[model samples]
Target: MNILVTGGNGQLGSELKHIAFQYPQLNCMFTDVEELDITNQDDIISYVEEHNVGLIINCAAYTAVDKAESDIERARIINATAVKNLIKACELSSAKLIHISTDYVFNGEAFCPLKESDQVIPLGVYGLTKLEGEQYVVSSNEEGIIIRTSWLYSSFGNNFVKTMMRLGVERESLGVIFDQVGTPTYAADLAGAIMSIINSNEKLDKKGKVYHYSNEGVASWYDFALAIFELSGIKCIVNPIEASEYPTPAKRPYYSVLNKKKIKNDFNISIPYWRDSLRSCLYEIEKSN
Candidate 1:
């Protein structure tokens, strides 16, 4: 299969690039805005045709949560309009799409893990626009799978793990939100799951559907940060703080934990625990440095 991955430099995209080498049978092409601007339908279609792309993993997104509140136009254009353009291009090429979505689709009020069928009530402009992007793919009658994930981190990008790692070294103490709860997803693991889905024998009957995935366990921002410090052997003391202590322009969901039963059963894959993956991720980071 000829696979096209957008947002090639981002966390998940970088992991996909790192793992793509393992799949010698799949011809993978990585591209960012410079190589493939998703907002332009004509350019996307042209590239799809030229490359004969069979599967498109769209990782490009407007992920600045607080910043989106002030730049709704740019966020909407990228998250919604750009997605519509990609859907059209995929339709013309008869290609399948694997869209990366967010757990922020929910209002974050659920006490338990959120499922794919839950009610969507986005809390901020970023979440709202991301939800809009998912709808475009769902309603376009295209062959695709929308995987909604949460709290992604990787060695390659600016994410929570990197942020905490930096803070642990620079400061003697740090305050992280303990009230907001969710899983900390390792981008490498998520990348593996995507590849597994691509190579699975599961029918297209499950196509054009939404699914949820992350690491196996749940944690608050405080717990996640503490794990980072402990695993990295940093001496910083991470204090648990309520969400109100560090408020941003966009409101964060109180609970965004995603249920993986649907994705696990559908793809027949096992997920790793959050702490286990955190250790592995930290090890990789250390090796790189």
Candidate 2:
């Protein structure tokens, strides 16, 4: 089967590229906007038809939360309208779509881990557009999976872990917000789960599915930074700070921890602990350097 992965150079897409070789049966083509613009429905149709893509893993998104506030049109075009174009193309090609979403779709007021069935109340433009994308994904009759993940980082791209590692060395001290709570997801793990779902014997197109995925533990941004420093042996004092202390244009969910029981049970996917995955990513990063 032909598998088309959009956002080819993104964190998740990069990880997917790293692991694609293991699944030799599926012919996977990774593409970024320069390669294939999902905003143009005709382009998506042409690419899918030419590639004979039976599945699409859409990782393309406008993830700049703070910047999205100022660039609403750009964000909306990428995160919402572009998704509609993909859905239309997927329908024409009879391709199942595996769309990636974020935990920001909910307001940070929840007392517990978020479930797939939980209410969605986006706090800012980025989250709102992502939610709009999810709406388009699920509202379709085509078979697909919508994965909402949080705190994603990987060795292949710039992320919280890499940022902490960089700043930890350049500066002696760093203040990370401790108020926000969530789990960190290694892109490799999420990519593995995606591969498993598509490679499984059962037909995923038989039913529509949405699942929450992250590392198997909880952490605040402070804790995450601390782990990065510890794993990398970076001698930096990571001070705890409140979200209000370092305010941004967009408000983040104070509590966006996701519940992974559904995905684990459904796909039999094994999720490593946050620290374990962090260490693994750090090891790869350090080795590469």
Candidate 3:
């Protein structure tokens, strides 16, 4: 099978690139925006035709939450319009699409873990646009799987883990939000889950479906930071504070822990706890540096 992954340079995309080698049956083509502009329908069509792509793993997205407030047009273009284009391309090529979505789609009002069928009430432009992308994929009436994830981090790119690591070394103290509760997903684990879905191929029959995935267990930004520092052995004081204490342009969901029962049962996979994955990621970062 020929698999084409967009946003190849992103955290999850990069992890997919590294692990793609393990799946010898899959011929994976990794393409960032430079290689394949998802916003351009022509580019996608040409690439799909040329490569005989069987599956499209769309990881490309406009992910700047705060900046999206003022940059709605740009965010919508990439998050919504670009996703429509990819769906169209998949439709034309008869290829399966596995699109990554976010937990921000919820308003963070629910005290319990959010399920796949939960109502979405996005609090900001970024979440709204991402939810729009998810709607586009589902409405396309094409073979697709939409995976909603939260608090994703990895050894690649600029994520919370990397930021915390850098601050731990450079600063004496750091303040992180304690009120916001969610799971910290390791990108490698997400990538592994995606690969597992592809390998199983059973879920493909249930296309146009949505599933929630993340590392098992929940933690606040403050707790996640503490874990990172502990795993990395960085001596820095992490101050836990409320969300209102650290204001931003975008209003984040206070609680967005996604339930993994559906994906776990459907794929028959065990998810690692957030702290364990954090430890593994920190070790990888340490070895790289």
Residue 184 displacement in candidate 2 (angstroms): 0.6
- Colliding pairs, model 1: none
Error of 3 at 72 (Å): 0.6
Model 2 Cα lDDT, one tens digit per residue, 75-150:
9999999988888888998988999999999898998999999999999999999999999988888878899999
Residue 255, candidate 1: Cα error in Å is 0.6
Assess candidate 1 and give its lDDT: 0.91
lDDT of each: 0.91, 0.91, 0.92
Q: What shift in Å separates residue 239 of candidate 1 from its native position after superposition?
A: 1.2
* Candidate 3 structure quality by residue, lDDT tens digits, 184-238: 9999999999999999978464633899999999899999999988888999999
Task: Give the lDDT of residue 51 in candidate 2.
Answer: 88
Cα displacement (angstroms), candidate 1, residue 148, comes to 0.1
Off by over 4 Å in 3: 205-208
